[model samples]
Target chain A: MNDDALPPARAIEFWFDFGSNYSYLSMMRIEALATARNVRIVWRPFLLGPVFRQLGFENSPFVLQKEKGAYVWKDMERQCRKYGVALTRPSTFPRAALLALRVALYGANEPWIGAYCRKIMQLNFADDREIGLPEVVSEALGSLDLPAQHIIETAQSDANKLHLREQTEAAIRRGIFGAPTFFVGDEMFWGNDRLDDALDYCEAMSRRDR
Target chain B: MNDDALPPARAIEFWFDFGSNYSYLSMMRIEALATARNVRIVWRPFLLGPVFRQLGFENSPFVLQKEKGAYVWKDMERQCRKYGVALTRPSTFPRAALLALRVALYGANEPWIGAYCRKIMQLNFADDREIGLPEVVSEALGSLDLPAQHIIETAQSDANKLHLREQTEAAIRRGIFGAPTFFVGDEMFWGNDRLDDALDYCEAMSRRDR
Candidate 1:
């Protein structure tokens, strides 16, 4: 019923990027829903920049398509209202997520990963802070009572950088072209709206095994 | 609680394209949901091709993004299963929706629009028939006991063609960039996932007024 008892593939693999707005919604809300369903979450932090590049775009689809970009901002407002989350439109879109992503990668398997991600998302989305800065990221980790400087240093190391790269490549291999994608077994569910559907699938699968 | 009693802007404006896979999902399920909520449905049929072209894309985003295209087909299968609807992979994608869209435009304000749209969607997504053909459209109308030849002729008239063009232009002006878009007084909700959300919003607004 808990993380330890569940099979590795039985849990939902949550692949997301720090810079993704919709990912902010999932990062904020996924835990409570998963816990209620007794489903475990495997946080997999990766960059979407490379994914977009591979798809022949140098920017987010929101940026590439102007009408879509406008609709997204408006939609974000409505979605935030519906989800009861605060949203301050980021002045700098797609802020350099490298540092925050690497740091999230540092805590991916830890209990603190969820807290760290939520903190980073709050900085970027809720507060409109430049989350790409080391100071911002450090402060977020420090606020969580973690050794901020040490974690940031470790996250920036060449080996961890390689880990992040491999993770993004893995996401591409899994056919992920967008953020906030969830995988329950081999079934992939994209977008924040599908989070519930993904968790439902996970719970159903677990029940079947019982 | 009926369509006559609801205010014009209070009802949900459903903008869709015949070729859009997500639109198929919404078209099939919208009526029952709308009826339950005592919300009126204003069907607005438009072509996405021109919208995509205006955004500088010559084809659907699904065609432009390969990984996304593959994911969409897979997602369609999952969505169809979840909705308890049959799905046969269309041998031809984006099959000339021009004719079907024009026909739907002719029935936009009519009660038969929903049935016509569902029939067209079934022909394309459920039955794997080439819905772009005139005869396929005629047969679909005939099955509904409507005057097939007459409707087809009227739908193809220059004036109706003008109406369809103006509708597509209207969609672009309204900042719509995707299919299965719903509007409740300028509140735009895009994609099939947001259909229920849109309906709920409509019902909530109606309740507040009462």
Candidate 2:
């Protein structure tokens, strides 16, 4: 398959949870990656807490698996270095993500979703700040020239909660068990590092159709 | 720190699950890696089923995430090709691992634990066969001129199960949630690909001590 032959690359739907460190990496890079590959990105923010609960997990997999957890922290450093992205471990993980998720969901339809999402991720991962706090969230929105009250108000609405729930269930149906998952047609790629491979697959599939 | 100034490398305890695909890759390459780096390797095999159960994962993460599952199969192909290893999807996944895990636990006292572990991994991953079946497990053992029954008997003993359980608990206590996990002193590297970086860490630590 050639890169130009398949249907124009479908919007790459990114289902992420704010508390996920790897998701932070993917959120930071998705825009540049999409532009380079001529693909579109759709941000879908959901609660990993719910997913983990359903899967019987009390915390992040890194905390559950000693060796894997240790590796991930170091591996994150390596990846950040490779990508030339600055990274500092978040002070408190599994942070209360309700507000951040609500904000992202509220901004889901805005033209500035990409910028807003990146900022939130950077606030937590790169800046080592608490993203769950209302004030921290408000400040991030204020810097974007977005009205914090409007975003928070929309996020707190029953409509938005239902919307978020539906998306989470949809992700479950789509076979997603973690944050930072991507799909192209029937193919799924998990983790931030797999972003390039996912894009390559789309490019290859497009070529094949041509 | 300079690489040569490091202290002598401490033995690496390799914790593996028989059914893990990545573990298969690591088991195959560990010897060559250990030799080149002059580090001792201690083979530790434990049951992933129990670990998963404890972590509340009913199946592989790939299976849980549809998009991820799709991407993983293809990615596995790409990675296998890169490593020049055969990549065939095993017919039976989460294969019955009782016998295979037992063999590993039984061989813990032997000098050939590393070599024997590698052979089983190749047989399961490279040959795309079921490692749980006695015939398949025995054939792999016979090729090494080891008595299959003796290994099986040892693996089935209460002592081995106790040992395996202890190791699993230790891993959990250490915050390990996945296979192919490596530890150098207190530094942890989680995946097979991270072997080089883990070795780099070991080299650095050894130098610092000197």
Count of backbone collisions within predicted model 2: 22
lDDT of each: 0.87, 0.76
Per-residue lDDT tens digits for candidate 1, residues B98-159, read: 88889998888887888889999999999999998899999999989999999999999999
TM-score of chain B of each: 0.94, 0.89
Please, what are the lDDT tens digits per residue for candidate 2 over residues B91-118?
A: 7665657777777877875877877787
Across all candidates, what is each one's fraction of true contacts kept?
A: 0.93, 0.60
What TM-score, over all chains together, does every model reach? 0.94, 0.73
* Tens digit of per-residue lDDT, candidate 2, span A28-109: 8888888888777767788887777666678887777655666677888977886788899887875767888887877776
Q: Model 1 clash pairs?
A: none
Candidate RMSDs in order: 3.6, 6.2
Backbone clash total, candidate 1: 0
